[model samples]
Target: MSDKYTFLTQAPVHRVIGVMAIPTIISMLLTSMYNLVDTFFVGKINTQSTAAVGIVFSVMFFIQAFSFFFGNGSGNYISRQLGAQNTKDAEVMASTGLFYTLVFSLIVMLLGWFFLEPISILLGSTPTILPYTRQYLGISLLGTPFIMGTFCINNQMRFQGFTKYSVYGAISGSIINCLLDPVFIFGFSMGVSGAAVASVIGQICGFVILLIMSQKEGVIHYTHRRISFEGRFVKEIIAGGTPSISRQGLASVSTIALNSVAGNYGDAAIAAMSIVTRISMFIFSVIVGLGQGFQPMCGFCYGAKLYDRVKEGFWFSTKIGTFFLLFWSVVLIIFSGEVVSLFRDDPEVIAIGIQALRYQMIIFPACSFMMMANMMMQTCRKTIRANILAASRQGLFFIPLIFVLPYFYGLFGVEICQPVSDIISLIVTIPIVWSAFKEMR
Candidate 1:
């Protein structure tokens, strides 16, 4: 434990974040593949199947919100506790976070089963896409508890400076999902349902591997006996995690709103937009990976009251993240049509998706700063500022624009909504981030 704390505090900021970012970057890409792999295989079956997976992705995001809420929330507290040499509190938080994540995810699964069809419709499923969406969503519900649990544990593990396990666990599930996708979707003739099954199986594999990794030397152990329901422990998790949940939960909401708006054009529009969103996320994983790496270091430095180190790490990561995204955005824009075509070959889908993808890519480089700032704020316990920035992209800006923009520009409005939101959110992020750094001193 002492060794881990020393590494987080004394290690050179660039070297430490680099060591952390490598595995986390790979892990984030693999995690995104959980959706992209399914999208890739399901597209072969038909556009409706592709659309089904996309529609159900909102539920996956919502489930992930719980994981982030528990995982990141607990992780922030755990890293701080370790920094302060408070081992007992760290153990209790590890167990408590795991226990609650399992319970909450199970509840989500049960509630989803009762309202499956309504959710499918609400998530922008057209009549043709309804049946396929139901099949995919039904099987996906069964895996919620496991996937959410894995996500929580993964975050906990990364926060401990054991990010190699995160990469390994993510790789295991991604490989399994990739191998199983074709076999189940084609060999078993299961269609969209098969894609969902592959994802669930992959998630279960990840969950099992992560559980085993948690027992590794120098890592925190999760046990029921250590679980705490005390207000102090609970509040710590809430304070650290609220920003993550706000971001992810509102992502689900914004996606649902985007789909509903796109539906007016046709199922083709829905599929195109869905593919575009997935593509954007895939490219943006680099930023998320960097933020993940920055978080643990930020939390530890702030906890130890090495505030200058925390500030330096944030700036270093933000610069690196923005550069990487800038490079990728240029590449993606140059080949936007082919990128969208790789997911689905339909002329209409590709055409609509290309425009959306290109527009989003234009603003993509700006998101890195937004994310790094939010993570820094959340780790430093600047909850209100962090939550506002977290919610700004989807909830504060995107949701309202989705409804208002279409009235002015129709289908073009839907295509441009997210980029416009990113711009506004980027503007809002500057003042909040500026205020946060000032408050930290």
Candidate 2:
């Protein structure tokens, strides 16, 4: 047994969480910063070009869905195995996840390239935006394997309690991407294609870094011999991973739905909504990083049957996450227009985005509880309950609301759908979390 993980089971809950979360928070913030950088540079193009990136974002979310599926699925299992002192199973899970993610991502890349035009159209790109979308999406898909592989490797390292290493990979990639964004976009005159190329190269850097780090002693090591295609191993991955897949997959679906609905208002509306989504995600990343910091603890304590510690960590994380989100929500509300203007200066985009951003912020604090509940369930291996909670926010609620609300209220309906869904998901989360805690008791 490694002495490194002793703190997870014995250290004070708050201290353990702080140690794990700070690096993740930095990594998440940097990741969001580079994404904002992408929007910043791409916004310098035209509104149509900005809208094109918005349209392609749904496709990017789809790719991320699968990457997270494999990463979290195997990561969840690995964390518990390590907790139970089953190093052999942990290693197999690691290898299986990386191997399968590579194969599946390659297949997705091929399919994405083969049907690039239709895929772009399907993501709600208008005729004007279609050309830029193709240019960006075509190049972006080429890095699917690396992006997916990086995600898997990062997750495994994180679950193994090697969060600093994960941070190193992620921060390095974001720094590289940010540096290259301007050079490729302006210096080389590559435009949107330049941004896509920079992104791919950045992902490649992170992937390489993570791959090297994963091989270090006391971390999960990937080797050809550990790869397994057996049905049982695959089932375990699917069981553990389904929540992530459902959550991310629903996000992709909801984004597509959002883009399509917003498209009715015009390309400006789509662009405005895109900026709002990016900014909201940037703010929400802090909460997510905190939740992620709590996840390995949940897995380890649960596996070790330290139920009290699990519960303690959950509440502590929730309180901290809520406080930070509330603070940011106020900041965003106060400067909604200015924030929206930072991305694009169009009067119409600013008008649409300001209202949308405020509406989303109304429920930002609720997400702390919702996310912690989901993460707790997932880490504790309550797969079905986790999936239900995961799917509800975007899939069951947001999807229906997106279609239905727009019918009655039009643009306002579209803007408010997410906040409404978030509120209801929070309502649903209370009982689910309560029940899980009861089980632990």
Candidate 3:
């Protein structure tokens, strides 16, 4: 490792976290840009088409949640092993995680491809939005393996403290996605399929680049040698990573629940909710990116038994993430209507979307706490607690809130559910923070 990246193993907590987080933040922002760029192109087609993109987000997140479960789970374990000077264990974790991701993604692709119509319908596809949803989902599903594999590879690299390479690979993919969006969507008149195709192509490019670079960089090996699944390795990976999986997996579930509620108001409501979600995600991605940057430092410090470093890393990451997100949420709140209108010009959709976005902005900062806390706890192997909190934001709390809230407040309730759950999760996270920091300090 270079002097700069030496923070992965040994460095002052603040500096180490900074070194690790910048690239991750860039990568995460770039990742979000892929979605935004696609949203921009899809928005040109009409409100229904734009909403189709949002409709399919839950399915994508579903696939991603599983991939994250294994990839992040394994990566977290591997990082700690490396920190503990268990290189072989780290290798095992890497190989096992990659294999698991490939297998899971292939299965998801098959299911999604075969049942595209029903799946889309189930994901909140209104009759007007069904065609666009199917078109985007069909092609996007085809790229599931590539997307999931690339995600796994990136996580592995980040955990191994090769974050610069991870950033480069992701940036390359984002650029390709951005460049291809206009070409496929407009130039070829493929519409939603065009967006899906562009996304897959980008993921493939990213996977290839990371695979080759990983070998050259000696970060991890992708060899013809058979990778045997060790039970212990799997257990360790699953335990450490389950929190991430629950966080993302539950997010997928939460999205579905959110869509179901939005569906009650008709296509316009679906479209409106979609725009609101995309806008919120655009802002939230930065916070997530920064938190991801701190993962390596947290894991390494925990592994090295540098408890003080862990506390310092957690505080710095939380402070910076909160500050950035607070500023963005304010901006989003101020121009909430404009932001919603950018995705769909339909008057009714924009009206609902503006309301949804405003509520989301109000709850945005509270949401950050659960996210950052989960990252810290999971990276340090406090899996069970992390998983509970991770599941809270979208799964446990969101499911009930979305269901019950809509009954009382109707559409407004549906729009406000996520932020409410986020607030609840944030409140719950306080004790986790106090105890974690107290112990570490």
Candidate 4:
């Protein structure tokens, strides 16, 4: 066995996961922080501007959905192929995934520009927020190709355990975005358009840097020759990646539903919910990082039939993640108002943001297991169960709740819908995870 493969399959589970997770954690944090930075700066523009940013998030969500679709699908397959000592298949699949994402980017950008205004309106923009939404969403659509490409390559690298390079790209993009945000927004006087421009520039930079870094000795480099149109490769990608697409695609729709419902209350409600989503996302990014660390290991150990190690990695991550989020919950809950105010100081915005933030945090820890299960199941190639689990939180549950809660509780229902979905999703995942472990035994 190759030294790297042996280390991955046999290393102490904690040590392996811990080492792999650090860069990914940092990458996810920096990426997530950029969104918060956008929210923080745009909040200063006006509540309507903030609401516009929130509405555009549905577009961003869709971008990420396809990116993760290629990323997770090819990534999971690459890790397993490498584990089984098949470098040629891994190399081919790597390029194929990126090739697919670029095609998706072209389609999204074309359709997005063709129907920009109507699309913005469909994303739940109020008349007051529509202009800003168009500005932001226009810039977002322009950067779709670069942003989605960056995300796709980053996932491919992470699954291969060469996260060392992925972190550099994430850091570069985040730093540039941060520096450019203030210059464009306040210095250049571009308003909402400024944030969008800065963000896209960063994605372009990250995409370039990651392409360079992927050429390092151990990482898989994308080559056109390796791009395969074979049915088997496509099937593997679908099996592994469908969970991400399901999770993210539904998340895209769910955010649209969320923004649509929040708009019913007013711009303030939309702005408040937007702020809460950013803050909660920042916290959830850490858990995702931890699960990502576990993923390669899960794929590797399972491929090698080292089933016990796979289980160990899963439990180890779940325990650490639950506690980590639980601790953050306490901190965020205690300072909910204070944190919400940091993003936007409007009294109405802060009031609504605080209530929504606290509601999500109340059952926040439960989300750790749900997320980890999906990652684990997908990595192990349990497609059907994983897809079902992936669909539950944002799709089957969140969509219905978002519509129903507003009918009964008005704004309060909008605020509470997500956590309720989360609670029920956790319940659904318990049986799936148990059965998976039983099968492994």
Best by lDDT: 4
Candidates sorted by lDDT, descending order?
A: 4, 1, 2, 3
Q: 1 or 4, which is superior by lDDT? A: 4
Per-residue lDDT tens digits for candidate 1, residues 55-171, read 999999899998999999999999888888888998899999999999999899999999999989999999999999999999999999888998899999888888888677778
Q: State candidate 3's TM-score.
A: 0.96
TM-score of each: 0.99, 0.99, 0.96, 0.99
lDDT of each: 0.90, 0.90, 0.82, 0.91
Candidate 4 yields a Cα-based lDDT of: 0.91
- lDDT, candidate 3, 306-391, per-residue tens: 88777777777778877777888899888888887777778899889888888888878766667888898888878777888889
CA shift of 103, model 2, Å: 0.4
Q: What would the per-residue lDDT of candidate 4 be over residues 246-293, giving only the tens digit for each residue?
A: 998999999999999888888999999988988998999999999998
- Lowest summed lDDT across 10 adjacent residues in model 1 is found at 432-441
Off by over 4 Å in 4: none
- Candidate 3: Cα lDDT at 394: 81
Question: Number of clashes in model 2?
Answer: 0
The true-structure Cα RMSD of candidate 3 reads 1.7
